[model samples]
Target: MVSSSSTPAAFVTGAANGIGEAVVARFLAGGYRVAMVDLDADRLRAAREKADPAGERTIEAVADVTDEQSVRAAISATVEAFGRLDAAHNNAGITSSGPNTHELELSAWQRTLDVDLTGVWLCMKHQLPVMLEQGSGAIVNTASIAGHIGYRNAAAYAAAKHGVVGLTKTAAIEYAPQGIRVNAVSPGPVQSDMLEASFERRGAAVRDWYYASSPTGRFASLEDIAHAVHWLASAEASFITGHCLSVDGGWIAQ
Candidate 1:
């Protein structure tokens, strides 16, 4: 069903920086009212200002995605502000810095799953109810190449992302009949401030290795993944539910 209002609305988690920030900008550019949800209050505010300078179409929800109550409140606030939810992107996640699967601490594994897997689930839990009531919505989850394949040392992150993909598929199948389409974007290495910082710390050799890993010999820009996510949540992808669209630079193919 089309939105009752001429202006549609979106709620995006992890909207402070990187792909999340880019996604917010993309949605705003497309004329959608967006809720920018993130744990960093200052950064979230900065991002909202950058995306919607006039303060006409964006709301800042300073909530941690891992907390159930926080996630619920964020969604509630978004609905109260916008009147309805037309789309959501569960993009908040933390990567694991584990040394190896056998050497990883139990706490580390739990933390990764709590934020990456459970956080996405919690967002959907609240967002789905709103969409269900409206009988229309779209949801996009941020998976990763680790979800589809494997990441050498980041066992916990990979497992959590894999769970995200599974959850996306399950929800898609269950809600399609109700006019909600669910999908995921699995990105490989992306060109972002975080990745750039990693390069600075790890040196040129590490950067070259990442470049060589991708068949395209380069990392994806944040905009690339953001565009894929926006498209998945738009009407253009109405029939593309349960799909995990890869924004990798052909890395997983090899």
Candidate 2:
């Protein structure tokens, strides 16, 4: 049996809820110390309370993933708390609302790239050195089904996620020789708060159509994505790098 104390330390962003929160919980259960970062202070507190009832191996921070200073500080805090950074899940992101390619607002498009694509770049900029110094680490980035296929009124999101996949592959190649692994996870329609908000913005019928179209006959659960992330970040995936693992319930396959 693997001992909890022997598990490597991990840092996760967007960890206040949904898949991020579930990943934190799962990693903790597996005996790893984790640093959780989120933009929502109250939600972050709640997640900390629930995941680290004893506060023995978890640290929670409120930081904006899109801000360089904030992300840098959060990474610093993680190192401070955990003594070393062994793994990271850069999972914070936002969606675009019906921003079609032809009519997408420039500001909206820029914001999507800033948070989704550039944010991952910034996190990696700060995280890679820590891993390089240690000569071993793994990083899993959150992409989306949009990353692989173009969906109507989601041009900004698709473009940004594509950028994430591109970046992951590049970094994976650049640092693979240095004992670092970089990969990405693209999820389909999961029942997350992000989806709920999208439904409110796009209407129930459209959201229902998304759910109905999944080959799995239903949307993915948070745990489904969490489990995939766990494997990608574990020793089992040491040979996997520069790859985009899809946990989309065959959404893209079909």
Candidate 3:
């Protein structure tokens, strides 16, 4: 179904904004059809308008990653539209609980895991089946530098991201023999509303901290992270699987 056209298609979650949005933009520019999914229906509409106003290549789907039924339907809808699924970016996630775990509520911890960790698994549960049927697919999950290191005051977020890394690796190994590739991109601080909101909640002016930690002396651009996901999902990184590619600005190097 995908080969019917000269271009391929991708199903991307968290695609209304931030890293997800950038990734969708990248794929669309490369002439790939995209199913841009997000929980916010209005934002999804906005993204579709901005990226594919004529509705020729990009379609919008509203779904919660935490809901299996919703995720399943979203993927199914993508296939119905694009004819086949060739790539997926399980990039839907959230962060909270601030920097102080002791101050973190049990509810917050559960919510974090339900979304940031379980959500990714829920997506792959449905997506992998489609890829298995097609006998070829590429998946790139969004991870974080926090997944590799213990970041203070973000116990729930860190734990969930660490789980994402583990899942990415395990899935990569399990699915590679099936003509599928699974990988992850771990990014450092990026200039996004999500990160800005985190700093706001802490009443923390963290520009200097992000700058100091990065030898590059700046936060990662969203485009940088998007490019990593694009390459890993494309034929360019055919041999790269079960790998956690870090898009951090030398944060993990320190």
Which of the numbered candidates is closest to the native, going by highest lDDT?
1
The sequence of per-residue lDDT tens digits that candidate 3 reaches over residues 90-163 is 99999765648888889999999999999999999999988888888999999999899998888999999999
Which residue segments of model 2 deviate by more than 4 Å?
Answer: 1-7
**Model 2 lDDT per residue over 212-243, tens place:** 89887888999999888988988899999999
lDDT, model 2 = 0.90
Q: How many backbone clashes are present in model 3?
A: 2
lDDT of 3 at 144: 93
69: Cα error in model 2, Å = 1.5
Runs in model 3 lying further than 4 Å from the true structure: 1-6
Candidate 3 all-Cα RMSD: 1.5
| Ten contiguous residues minimizing lDDT sum, candidate 3 | 1-10
The lDDT of each candidate is 0.91, 0.90, 0.90
Give residue 239's error in model 3 in angstroms.
0.7
Give the C-alpha miss distance for residue 251 in model 2, angstroms. 0.7
